[model samples]
Each structure stands twice: as C-alpha cells, then as structure tokens.
Target chain A: MITLPDTASPLYEKVKDYILANIGTGRWGKDRKLPSENELVASLGVSRMTVHRALRELTSAGFLIRLQGVGTFIAPPRPQSTLIEINNIAAEIVERGNRHRSEVLVLETIMPTKELALSFEFPKRVSIYHSVVVNFENDLPVQLEERFVNPSLIPDYDKQDFSKTATYDYLMQKTPVTEVEHIISAIPADAETARHLGIDVGACCLFLHRRTWTGAVVATISKLTYAGSRYSLGSRYSPSKSS
Target chain B: MITLPDTASPLYEKVKDYILANIGTGRWGKDRKLPSENELVASLGVSRMTVHRALRELTSAGFLIRLQGVGTFIAPPRPQSTLIEINNIAAEIVERGNRHRSEVLVLETIMPTKELALSFEFPKRVSIYHSVVVNFENDLPVQLEERFVNPSLIPDYDKQDFSKTATYDYLMQKTPVTEVEHIISAIPADAETARHLGIDVGACCLFLHRRTWTGAVVATISKLTYAGSRYSLGSRYSPSKSS
Candidate 1:
C-alpha cells in the first residue's frame, strides 16, 4: 500500500489527493492497479465509507476506473469533445474543475474576403463583422477562435465585450441556429494563428470551421483552432443508424 | 464570355469541363457570379438543356452551388465525413469515382501491453491480434490504420489477407458492432506514420482513435492517421439535439 498523508481537507478529498499525487509522480502509472478499499482503509487509517466515496468520486471524475470483481486501475488521461455538438469553451473548462478565461484579441467590422463571401453566399462588397478570441484553460491558451458574423442578422455584434461573456453564449441568445455545418481538419498553424494560439508556427492544430444558419439566412461563420497537444474531439454512439 | 473547347465526351460533359477549367484556373473564382443559362448556351454553342444538365450534375457532385433565383456560382472544394457514422473507406472512394486499394503491412499475434491489458481487463500474459494496413485512394496514400483485436472475440483475425478485403468489412461480417467510440485529434506525424503516408516527419496529421464494442466485450481498437492535406471530416445537421 502507498503511504499517504493527512490534510485539513475532508477525509475523502485527502484520499483522492494521495492517489492523484502517486499517479502524478508515476509512483503509480497509467493502468496501474490501485490498492483496494480495504487496503486503503488499513494503510491511510480512513473509514471504509470514506474510502468508497473517494473511489467513487475519482471514478466519476475520470481519474480512476473500477471494474466489478477485477479491482480499480488508473484511467488514461483522455479529454473528449463530441464532434457533432457545438460546445461552449468556458463551460467545458469549468466542468473539468479548471479556471476559464477569455482574452479578446480582435473585434471589428471588415469587408468580406472572396472565400468568406462564397461561404456566406453574399456579395463581395458586403461588409461583415469579425472577431478573434482566445480561450484559456487555467491560464494556458487552448483555443483561438476567429468568427465572422452576418451584419444583417446580428447588427450589434461589434458592440459586445467578449471578455465578459462568451460570443457563443451571446449568439445563441440572439438567434437560435436552425442549421449548422462543421468541417474538421488537421492543419499546420500559420504565423498569425500561432501567435494567437501561443503555439509555434507549423505546429499541428485541430481545426473546425463552422457555419450556422437561422432559417434560410446565414447567421455566423467561425474558424476554431486548438493546440494539437492539448485537445481532442470524441463521441460515443450505438451502431443503429450509423456503422 | 469565356472561350472553351469542345471535347469528344458528351456535350454536357464538355460544358462541365469548361466550367471546371475556368474555376481551376481561378478565372471564375469562388463567389464569382456566373453568366446566365442563356449566356452559357450562347457562349458554349450548346443547347440550353445541355447547359442546365451540366450545372445540375455539378451541383449534385458538390462542385457547384445553384442558388434558386440567384443563378449558379463557383463552390469551394470541400470533402466531408460524417463524424457520427463509421464509413467504409473503399465505398467512400468509389463514391467519389476513385479507385481503392489496400496494402497489408503487419498481421500477427502479440502479447498485450500493460495499457492494453488494463483496457481489455485481462492479465498481462494474454495474447491479442494486431494488424497494420495502408489504404490508398487512386494511388495516393491517404490513411494509415493500425488495429488491435481481442483474440477471444475473433479467433481467425490473423488468417485473413487484408489486401484482398478490408478489416472493417470483415469484422462487420463476423461481428456487427453494437457500440462505437471515436476520439479525434491533430498531431505531428512520426517517422513511421509519415513514411506510410508519404509525408514528411513532423507534418500535421489528422488522427482518429476508434474503439468498437460488441455487447459488453471490446471487439476492436484502431489508430487511424491521415495526411493532413488530403482529408477532412464534416457534417451538416439541424440544431435539434446539438448546438
């Protein structure tokens, strides 16, 4: 059994921390079998109920996996995103018990580029709203989001301060999207995108280009780039309609 | 009006090629308004029905977008994969009018690693089936696939010649997956993966880790890496359950 410490925090939290510390220091590596509840209770001088609560909490938190009759083991570190669902970054960070913050980089109106005009199906001369925001997970930049908004759909898009509230939240409130398209790719980051993402140029980035429509009118278009080393998108489904 | 040549193919095919050539050369760039059907018929010296058929075919093939009441315009090149669906690579290539081939790289029995043992919830001494294959689209290497199978689930996994058949197809025949999970990321290609993909080491690649389960047992786990420049995954959906 691993020797553990006692802290002022709750007994369950202390047990959880001891387990995390061992795992973090590689004393117990990934997939390493965890000491059973009886062993933990005996070694740490904790109640069996406390030990069970700690293990259950850890399992739900995704740090541990408990198998019936087999025992407990360290769960691999895998953060996942549903590929089909559009998620708000701030909420995701908070769900992981991490601090979330947004830094507003660029927020202005601009003329549409040829590609933008084509995606939005608007004339080239039409002006659009554009903004750049970098979302931080515990102070580490994880996502750099560049967005284009149809001015006719949301006329006041340029007036909001994104640092206070996320753009996705604001957009959802203004116009509920009826249809959306997501395009995912792995791409090498350009210099400007790298600067905003705090990643090196030419580094691999998971890229998602999204377009949303309200009824028949285009609402918003966005380019979301995430640091390759930090993020993953995932989904679990039954093979009923798809396989 | 753009000048174009007549080809030995059908008249509609000639018209389609004429439009494609102009778009390819950036002569009629993205979002560039196209001449009316009357103008196309007059310029290409083809019947109105022929021009209409050409435009309709291109629209259905995702090469052009014909907006009702607004005429047709050059559409951006975008290939997509539905994230929730497990697609057959051969069928996908054939759907795009391309040839599909597979090169078998490795097929053998291997002892499970500690991680694999934990994932499979088996002892370290247990043996598993493993294979590596590279899939090609029209002679262009696009995907490098590595798979591990639970031996108890598929006893003859090693005996099949993958070059003659796809593993997914074979697995579906033997065991239809009841549930599946997909985890996606962007990562720099390693030397071996780059070699198989015909790309430079450290180039960005799209990586997908997929695991399929039959009832309570894990059937297969795969690591699929694609050349970053060659592939994208996309889906268009109503914002019903997701936003």
Candidate 2:
C-alpha cells in the first residue's frame, strides 16, 4: 500500500493522490481489480462520503473505473496534460502542478507575401496579424505557439494582455464559435523551434495546429508545439453517442 | 500539391486522403502553412466546393487549421489512436486500410473467489462472469482484453456473441449508461498478454481499465492491454466553459 497524506489535507484529495501514485508506481498490476468502496472507507479511516468523493473524482478524471455489481479497478497510466484548464495555455500549465509563465517573442501585423496571400485566401495587398509566443512551465520552455490572426476578424487583437489571458480564452469569449478544426503531426525540432521549447535539435516534438470559427468567418489560428519527452497524446472512446 | 483523385471516389474523402498523405510523407514541415482552397481548386482542376469539403474534414480531423484573415496552415501532428474505440475493435483495423480479426481465449462464468468477491462487494456465494479475447490488426496480435462482468448486472452476458459485437456496444444498447469511468496506464506485459499482443514479456504495453454504470448501479468492468508500437493515444483540447 502507498503512504497517505497528513490529516490536515483534504481526505478525498489525499486518497485520490495515493491511488494515482500507486498506479503510477505499478503497485497494482494491469487488470487487477481493487477493493470495494466500503473497504476503502474503512482502510483510509475516512468517512464513506469522503472516500466516495475521492473515487468519484478519480473516476471522472480517468484514474479509476467502477462497475455496478463488480468492483472498482486501477486504470492504466497515461500522459499528464501540462495544460488541462478551461483557460488557454498559460492557465493550462499552472493547473498542471507547475509554475506557468510566458514571454512575447513577436507581436505585429504584417502583409502576406504571394505564398501567404495564397495561403490566407486574401488579396495580395491584404495584411494579416502574426504573433509568436514562448510558453514556459516551471521556468522550463516547453511549447512554441506561432499564431496568425485574421485582422478583419479580430481587429483589436493587440489590446488584450496575452500573458494574463490566453488568446484561446479571449477569442472564445469574443466570438461565438460555430466550428473548430485541428491538425496534429510529429516532426523533429528545428533550430528555432528547439531553442524555444528548450529541447535539443532533432528531438521529436508534437505539434497541434488549431483554428476556430464563428459561423463561417474564421476567427483565429495557432501552431502549438511541445517537446516530445515532455508530453504524450491520449483520448478516450465510448460506444455511446459522443458529446 | 496533393494529388486529386480521379473523381471516382468520394470527392471529400479522396481530397482528405491526398492531403493526409502529404502531411504523413513530410511534404509540409512544422509550422508550414498549406495552399488555399482557391489554389487547390485551380491547380487540381477540382471545384472550390470539393477543396473546401476536403479542407473542412481535414480541419475537423485535426489535419489543418484555418485563420479567417490568414491562410490555412498545417497543424502539428500527434500520436495516432489505433485501439481506443468503443465500437467493434475489428472495424477500426479494417477502416485503417488493414485487416482485423479476433480469437476468444476464455469465456465462462465462475464462482467469485475471495479476491473477486471483495473487489465486487459481493458475497462469496455469487458468481462472476469472465472472458479473455485477443484482437489482431493485419494478422498481428495487437491487443488483449480481459474482462469481468457483474452477473447481477448483465445476467445473459454469456449468451452474447462478442465476436460480432463488443460487450461495450451491447451493454450501451441494452442498458443505457448514466456514468462511466476510464483509467489508462503503461505496464510490462505479462506472459499471457505478451503472447496475445505478440510482444516480449516485460515489454511495455498501454493498458486501459474501464467501468460503466446506469445511474448508481454498477454495470461492467474491463481491463484491456495493447501493444504500444501499433497503438498510440491522442485527444483534443478546446478552451471550454468549464475551463
């Protein structure tokens, strides 16, 4: 059994942490069902409600699963999302049990060249806004976000304090989105990208390009990349209809 | 430029496939933006509607992201999900341009042992249903699913033909779910699991243990293991109201 936390901490969080730690350490093997809820209540010397709360939260968070007539079991371990908050990247990292911060690399509006014009579907004379930001988790550079904003859609893009608020949150609030798109890929870190992410050149990094829309007008686009060693990808599947 | 299909196939699907192939083949580097719908329409001799359809699907599937005033850019690539489906696992393989099949290793109802009884919060006199199944992709064993069903919750589970339908789908249709939990981990494959997944014993395999529920009553529990090489995990994140 894993050690529990002091009594001062929330009993449920303590239980959740204990179970998660044990699972990470492999004290419980794969496919091994766990003790009952009543048993957990007794062993942890916590109230039934407290034990249930911990179990419930863990279940929702994808750490433990319970069956109706069957018992609960430890779930397989997965990657920890450095950013899991409802907010954008800055808030996401802070919620990951790490200190979150950022620095503005480039913040400007510029004209698109011929290739850029063709890419943006804009006339050759039209301008597009571009921003590059480096996000840090616990003082360690982890992600490079290269952003291109539609000037026509977000005219006041420079008014917001991106450090305090994420572009994702701002755009989401300002625009009622009717569509969202993402593209994910893997590539070796290039010199510039590697430097921004604090990863050695040639190391693998995962990239996510995201675009959001309000009705038919495009709202914003961003290229976010993370160091491969620092992250893993994960998703869940249910046979039922998805939300 | 992605090669457009000859219009013999689903136009949108073919276009998506062409774009995906280019991304997979490294034609677009990290942060590299893609051509616009107009360019694709003019160059491929396809209608803008067709190009938009393809781009729209790829964007939804996380292949490309678009900015309103800016052009569309290639999204970062993430890991691919090979076996995280709640639908029939066999179907997923076939859809991936590969062959899939399964072999049942064990299917029986047995009296609950002490450990099993304690896990399910059931009396030792009750019985528990168990099954072991191995699934293959392209004739290579890729997954081992060891599951335990609550006899009380799923009384006729043994009569179901799992070879045609997954237990998850069956349960979801028969008993509507009110709650479900998922756990993911990495563990060394046991001899049996290793043999099923065609990996050496002690090699790392991704594992998932899931439990389903209808209201407060427990439904079923399943422990599944997969060969990590063939199965990668992925998920998407959007700044939602909860964040």
lDDT of candidate 1 over A68-168, digit per residue (tens): 89999988643221233345777778878999999999999999889889899885569999999999999999999999999998989999999988998
Top candidate when judged by TM-score against the true structure: 1
TM of each candidate vs. truth: 0.63, 0.44
Candidate 1 CAPRI assessment class? acceptable
Docking class of 2: incorrect
Q: What is candidate 2's DockQ?
A: 0.03
* Per-residue lDDT over B1-243 for candidate 2, one digit per residue giving the tens place of the 0 to 100 score: 445657777876777777777776777665577778898887677799878868865675566789988988887532211222133455567768997777778889988678666656554567778988888887888778888788776778888787777655566445545455665545556798777787777665656666665545556677877776566434343322210
In model 1, the clashing pairs are B81-B234
Assess each model's interface with DockQ, reporting 2 decimals per model: 0.27, 0.03
True contacts kept of 2: 0.01
